[model samples]
Target: MFRKWESPEAVFHLLKACSKGMPCDITGIDDYRMIDEKRGIQWPLPDGHPIEPLSERRLFEDGQFYTPDQRARFVFEAPRPLPEPTTSAYPLTLLTGRGTSSQWHTQTRTGKSYVLRKLHPNVPYVEVSPKDAAELGIRANEWVIVRSQRGQVKARVFVSHVVQPGQVFMPMHDAATNQLTFAAFDPYSRQPSYKACAVRIEPAPVGRSNHSALPALNLFIASLGE
Candidate 1:
C-alpha cells in the first residue's frame, strides 16, 4: 500500500490530497530540487508561491484571520471527571513517564544499545514515598506488585521523597506499565491518557528479594531523566 510513499512525487500528491489550504498547504513542494534549494519549505506554500526565505513567510502578518469576522476561534471544554479516581481500595495515584535519557518510549530501539543499557536501571521499578513505604512495609529495591483495577505489574521499589505520600511513579519505558494503566480517552481530541491512575502497592513474598541480583538505586543522584 505504501509502495512509493518514500519518493518525493508520492509525498507531493499525498500532501495535495489532504491539503488544508493556508494552514498546511504544501502542494508547491513538488520537486526534490525545490526542497533542496529551499532548504525547507514552510507549510501553506501552495503551487506558484513567490520565492522567499521559508521563515520570512510569516502568518497573520496583518493580524487578521480568514473567519468572516477576521478573528481567531477559541475552543473551550468543561473539565471531565478523573478517569480513575483514588478510592479506599486503590489509595495511591500512579504516574508514568520517561525515566532516563538513554531510553525512549517503550525502549523499542534504545534498549538494544550496550552503552545505553549500562546507563540506566535494567529492571522496571516504581517510586514510592518513604512515608508510604514505611506504612506498607516496603524497603528500597524490594519487589512489589503495583495493582490497579485494570491489572498489575511487579516492580522493584525505590522509596524516595520525590513522590508524594499518596502517589507513586513508574517509567513509561517499561512494556509492563501498560498492563496496569487504565485505558481512558479524551472526548474532544480523542487522545488516550497515560498520566494518572489509581493503584495500590504491596511487597512481594519473602523469597522475592534477590540480594545479589538487583542493583539498588543511586538515590543520591535522583535526577534519572526528564
Candidate 2:
C-alpha cells in the first residue's frame, strides 16, 4: 500500500519502464547500508553519481520523456462520478483525509500518550461552509452531526470559506468520523476516495434539562402558586 506521506509516482513510473523492456542500471551494490545511503539518489545521473543524496532534479529537464511525440499520454481516467453526487437525500458531500502529521487511521492508539495527543488534540477539525453553518444555526467550533449514506458521527464544526458551499472536510484521524464515511474503493487503483463523498450535517441535538436552570426558590414559589 502507498503511504500517505510517500509519493507513489516514482515507483509506478519505474515499474512501467521495466515492463516495456527498458533496462535499469544498478552499480552492483545491494546491501541495506547502500540502499539507505542511496535513498536521495536520482535516476539517469551521469556516471551514476547523484548530485545530491536526495535528487532534487526534475524530470524532463531536456524536454523529452522517451516518447516519439514528446508528449505524455492521457491514457485513462477512472470515472469517479463524484461520490454521493446528487445528495438529494443527503444534501451535502464529505471529504476526509490526513495532514502532514498524525500517524494512523485512528487516534485511539495515538491518543493514549499525553504528549502525542496534546501535540495535536482534536486538530484538523471538521470544516463546513459559512452558509451551511448559518442555515443550521451553528457557530464555528460548535458540534454538528455529519451523516453519510453509511452512517453518522458528531464533530465540531469549523466554518470557513475553504469549505465549499455544500462540501465538508474531516481528517480521517478520528475513528468516530470514519463511522459516517463512505468506504468505496477505486476499481483500478484499489484506492478509496476518502475525499469527495456524499454526506449531510446538522446541528446535533443538545441534551440539557429545561428546568435545570431554575433556582430552588423559583421552583418552590411556582409550586405554592400551583
Candidate 3:
C-alpha cells in the first residue's frame, strides 16, 4: 500500500494531507526550502546541498559486504523473564503501555492544560485477567492498590480478555503508577521494564496508619489548646 510513496516528497505530501485532510503541492521546491529555512537554515539553500544530506550513503564499494569476506555475521542473545512475577500476594502480572486517547506520556505537560486534563486525568489503572478478578474479588472501574517492591498506588481496575491468565496491563501515564514500579534498567537499552512487572492489587486501605506518631501529634495539639 505504501509502495506509491518511494519518493520523500510523496511521503511528506501524504503526511501533510493526512494531518490537514487537504491535498497540497508535493512537487514544489519552495516547501523544501521553507523547511530548511525554518528548521535547518543550511540545507537546500538553492545551492544543491542539503543541510545534512547523506553524504556517505554506502561504504566498502567493492561489490561486497562484511570484513574481508561476504559472509554474514550472527548475533545471539539469551532470553530473560521479566523482573516482576504473578505471585500469591501479587497474583496478577501487570504490563503497562500507552493510553488510547490524546494525552502525551505521563500527561506531564498535557495534564496541565485544562482541556487535556479533562480528557485524561493523572490516574494509574491496572488491567486484570478475568481469572485474576474472580480470585481477587474485584471488578472493573473499582479502585485497587497496586503494590510493588518500591511503593504502592491506587488505580482503577479494568478487565479484558486480551490479558492472559497471569498477566495484566497498564498505561504508564500516572505518577502513582511510577511510584509502585521499579526503576531497574535494561542491560542493552538502559530502559525500565515499564511493560511487564510484578504487582498485587487489593482493595485500597481505608484508614490512616495508627502508628504512635498520631498520638504525638494529638498531644501536641492538646498542649496548644491549653
Cα lDDT, all candidates: 0.78, 0.61, 0.62
Q: Which of candidates 1 and 3 reaches a greater TM-score?
A: 1
Please list all clashing residue pairs in model 3, or write none if there are none.
43-51, 84-198, 95-170, 96-170
- Count steric clashes of candidate 3: 4
Clashes of each: 0, 2, 4
Q: Please provide, for model 3 over 30-148, each residue's C-alpha lDDT reduced to its tens digit, 9 standing for 90 to 100.
A: 45557666563422123233434534423334454444476545557698776766577766676777754657778767778887655554455677779988888987666678887
lDDT of 2 by residue, 157-207 (tens): 666677788777887887666677667787656887667777777777765
TM-score of each: 0.72, 0.55, 0.58
Top TM-score prediction, candidate number: 1
Q: Which candidate has the highest lDDT of all?
A: 1
**What is candidate 1's lDDT per residue for 1-226, written digit by digit as tens?**
4775978678667767678466677767767677787787776777777766534767777678878898977779888767999999999999999877778998889989887776765677898999999999878777889999988888888877789989999989889898888789987668888889999997766563444335434441244433
**Angstrom error at residue 4, model 3:** 47
The list of candidate 1 runs beyond 4 A from truth reads: 5-24, 31-36, 57-71, 77-81, 108-115, 205-226
Tell me the lDDT of candidate 2: 0.61
Q: What is the C-alpha RMSD of each candidate to the true structure, in Å?
A: 4.4, 12.4, 15.7
Clashing pairs in 2: 40-53, 40-54
